[model samples]
Target chain A: MYVAVKGGERAIDNAHAFLAEERRGDPAVPDLSVAQIREQMALAVNRVMTEGSLYDPDLAALAIKQARGDLIEAIFLIRAYRTTLPRLGYSTPVDTGKMATTRRISATYKDLPGGQILGPTFDYTHRLIDFALAAEGDAPPAPQASPLGDVPRVTGFLDREGLIEEEPASDATPGDLTREPMELPADRALRLQALTRGDEGFILSLAYSSQRGFGRTHPFVGELRIGEVAVEMDISELGVAIEIGEITVTECETVNQFTGSKTQPPQFTRGYGLVFGQTERKAISMSLVDRALRWKELGEDDTGAPVQDQEFVLMHADNIQATGFLEHIKLPHYVDFQSELELVRRLRAGMTEAAE
Target chain B: MGLLARAPADRLAALYPHISEHAVLRGPETGAVMVRGRQGGTGAPFNLGEMTLTRCSVRLPCGKDGHAYVQGRNKDHARRAAVLDALLQTEAIGEVTARVLAPLAEAESAQRTARASKAAATKVEFFTMVRGED
Candidate 1:
């Protein structure tokens, strides 16, 4: 006869209380405010917002505070909180072509029309940490320059010359991955959506793998731009479009080498990435992976890489799902463990009897 | 609709105090929802993020059911909106519209105009001069 373990309600409550205390650290120290987290720990907040798929900085900060600064936990909180609200309306798709770019650079062209504006970037910065930043010190103001009017996309230049594959304009509504079940062999629109919200590290590894001959497609950084875009909604009652808000987005377009195929001539292919906020690494990785995933549609032979499998990549890309399943091991598995234990004992007894 | 949904709860309550007598058919509970985004205006839908929302349904004394869903986590606003919605379905529509909807609409319009003007103040226009060399 087996007795089930019980009577730990008070202990569980105490454990929770201890966790709260631990989260606070020292009582003597000042408690961190949501605003402080939003302002100072902005990159972490950005990551949470990007992964969480919500652009609200204040709410992201609050989630960070509630989760004790664990970014994944913060994202989880945001995800949980997001599922309850009703979707009021859908905004018009943001036009990245008209984006008021702050940082626009291209490796393919030095004298691009936009004239390389190196708006706040970590590319040139040395990896060495500055000790002076340990103490609060006001930094000098950055130099300002006027941006060129409507900096045309570098991809547009290629498109003009008919050097790249044409992405024909489509007006069909794409399926909502969250609302509907993810079907296999998803369209480009659906795949791009998944990649945008995919786990940054996971996507990065897959993208890196592609570059390392796993699915060798020589990708060039055609254009990477970060800026704010106006979010508009069409009000039927008002008979006009209104700008409800603005959100910062990072958009990347990668040009890849494509050899001539039976159906089409040799031309450069495009891989696209558009993500919430200023996450360049994620955006770049997303584009590379997106390009690799396009091998089937692009008439390239499948190398059987993990990244090439749409179902595998899309299904396991979410960190929230990954973490939830990974962490469920902590839950009680006594019944299963007991069965295993009995099996092992029975086998040992039989072995001893046979030996005797 | 957003403007109506976002109307201040206290103001709505003050406009119609008898809303307390309304029966809650459903919840004035707060919950999370996924927001979806489209590519290039009308392309594929993508998960934008989650947002907090409060919703409620109310049945008026006159047997009309009203439902309301609003952004953010204000339960009272959702409940009050539901009551107003219920009231709008009855003979008291005129009185409610005059007392509630009109003012809210006017206020929201004014607020929008102010915001637009504020944004417009910072708007810049660029022009390229014709150089003699060109």
Candidate 2:
């Protein structure tokens, strides 16, 4: 009675059905709306977009709704969706210098060109829970104001006096990590791409590790800026650039003490972090990790540390990729296991016969 | 979805509309067409540049609680696979299950059986002839 057992298709179907039922626990509970998820769970949306590499809040929100609040699954959805999108055109390097900033601050200098505006931050917020929000109560709307004429950037003032270091611009186009494989000895742009898409918690921990004598490079939050930036693409048909839309971006630049190494002089080194939406904490953490990884580039010794190793950093950075690959182990691997089992059986049999 | 074995490039291009029609398809803008793209053989790990992948997800009817995400090399393939998966739930699971999933399994079994029968039929019994040299 050797009937070849086969029911993966049925199993898959039933499993899916089970998952669907589980996603909607109770009929009485109000179903989550895309708008509600987008507005209320904005940080989750920001994380999805950051990891997904798509700036569509609506899509992210939809993904969130569909995934049943599983952020990584939402990210996976976004990534899959984004891959289908056609590459329209590359925008000219965004001038963060001319950014219409809502929150701008410089820890390096208090008296910079544009006075630091601590517009909005959860940094000072107390950890007390608001029990009133359990009823979904709506608060009165905050007052709005017209745009300021000239909202100068902190970096601009530094560039003027040559106080801050300037990264040289190259005519060569930057490599797209999504399209291409990540190669070793990555340039700044490639590194930044890995960092931006990297898991915030992981990066935060790694940055924290560096602070606690792992690869200690005392880093100060030099300038943390959160604002909306115009996304412009040069349309060949239009014969000029056109603004497609605006996206909120959080950019962090950490300034580390330039203790002169053996080879290079003591110049203020910088770590940069940029992410979609207002993610200052993530951006700051990213910057610290970036600086820690750049130790070798600045002719510093490779201390065999986690943050210093580019391969380790880039490989384990993206939560979507890492988690997906990690979770995939749950999938059927019986065939591969069977091969190993067969080998072990043969070897054990041979050993037994020889011993006998 | 239609069963047409298109060139990989065309299949790759077709993925854009299949996954998301709203997706920007600036194929020319990317110069990606000029770059040689090839996918690894079946069951091989997905590598960068070598292969073009088109993944898709569909919401199966909420029977249980979660959505069934069917990923594949082609968008249409993914959609078809998802549909098949969804159908197998409510439909006669036995026949379709064997037909769809173990399509390769059946083929492999047949191949092994054929090989074994062929080997048996052509069995080379080594018998020494008694008076051959004498």
Candidate 3:
């Protein structure tokens, strides 16, 4: 007689113990500290923070360490941790226009305000890896002088000429996607929120599809800025807004060509992306997808592209949800498989009798 | 307040040794909290990310309760800040203000000035000259 497989708890405990041992790798090497991950692996920390929707580098680094450098798992840890906290108060919005920019550039103009500050970027670097970096050595610090004054946004110049489509100022509050369940036909604000937290690779592919004639919007990089922005909170007790702290952010704006329609004249439409930390690729991709999703509002024909479908893009963009469902298949499905086997056997027996 | 709470505990302890005699009313526990962002400074609220925060509550012998929430896993900083917070509410406000907060505030401002100067050194001035070609 076959007894049901027991010792699931024991097996799980042993497996976890094995995983913990494997995670440490070698006893000969020193363990990586959270601070090391936070400082040295800054980009990875930034990505986890951007996707996890949290800004604390320390926690993000710890998550990265605990997740064994798996970004999606890090994001999952962050998301799980985020739900337990109390909503202290909402912070006043950050102003990218006033950002102390580290990197700023525009592809549309040869010369523009801010003189195209490249800051720290990997764009011009050759793909070849420097093997010398394999052996641990301290990197010599490059001397840099501070840039004076604020660099005016490139979009401001276009707006001054009335060349681009007018984005009227509105004081209306935007919906919080994290607090409320996402519904169809999401507004620009809600869509942007989704894109900022969306998976970088997924958004990149969607943005690429739009550029490759799937949606076909000739996008010009109007402005892309990465830097620090101050976060302030309105203290009702003090009756004044106080600066809580500063956080690094990446903001992108894309200019897309729009032809004349019956209701509107020919003008350039805009797509915007803003994310936590220094994530230019994600920001650019998000902007492209943001513009694509605005097909209906822009009076453009629906191309039925996956990027244009807000529902599809937003729903599938989260890696945590995707990984959970995909990995769930590894779990036992013995009862369901047995039922299907019995049904097939019964059907085969009935078919043989009917044929006789 | 967050800045004061986030200030290094060892530094605070060294600067003000009087705050060590407070009772831990709540905890110097480590946890995580969600951070939020707004659209363009006054727009709708959106979830930004989770940040690791250390929080604690303390009661001074003078019967004042104080609390603190600081960024990172610095439990000592949280406890020290909470103790200071309680003391500040008592008659030692002037002394604590002079001994504790003044130094922290000065250090914070100096740090900010240094950062500003560093950023200002890279400033570029662009000029568009007329070629007289209409």
Predicted complexes: DockQ each: 0.12, 0.01, 0.30
* Model 3 misplaced regions, further than 4 Å: A1-6, A352-356, B2-69, B72-75, B78-134
What CAPRI grade goes to candidate 2?
incorrect
> Could you give candidate 2's fraction of true interface contacts?
0.00
> What is the lDDT of every predicted structure here?
0.75, 0.61, 0.77
- TM-score of candidate 2 to 2 decimals: 0.68
Sorted on TM-score, best first, the list reads 3, 1, 2
Q: lDDT by residue for model 2 over A1-356, one digit each (tens)?
A: 12355778988899999998888889799888898888988989888878777766777899998898888889889788766655544554555555556677788776655555665567667978978888877886433433333346555555566655565444446676876898998866677777878888899988888888888867777788766555444546437654434457787878777667676556677777777778888888888887888887677777777888898888899888788789888877787788889999999999999999
Which scores better on TM-score, 1 or 3? Answer: 3
Q: Quick one: how many clashes does candidate 1 have? A: 14
Q: How high is the DockQ of candidate 1?
A: 0.12
Least accurate stretch of 10 residues (summed lDDT) in model 3 chain A? A140-149
Best by DockQ: 3
Candidate 1 chain A TM-score vs. reference chain A: 0.96
> In order, what are the TM-scores of chain A for the candidates?
0.96, 0.90, 0.95
DockQ rank, highest first? 3, 1, 2
**Which runs in model 1 stand beyond 4 Å of their true positions?**
A1-6, A236-239, B1-134
RMSD of every candidate to native, in Å, equals 7.2, 26.3, 4.1
Whole-model lDDT, model 2 = 0.61
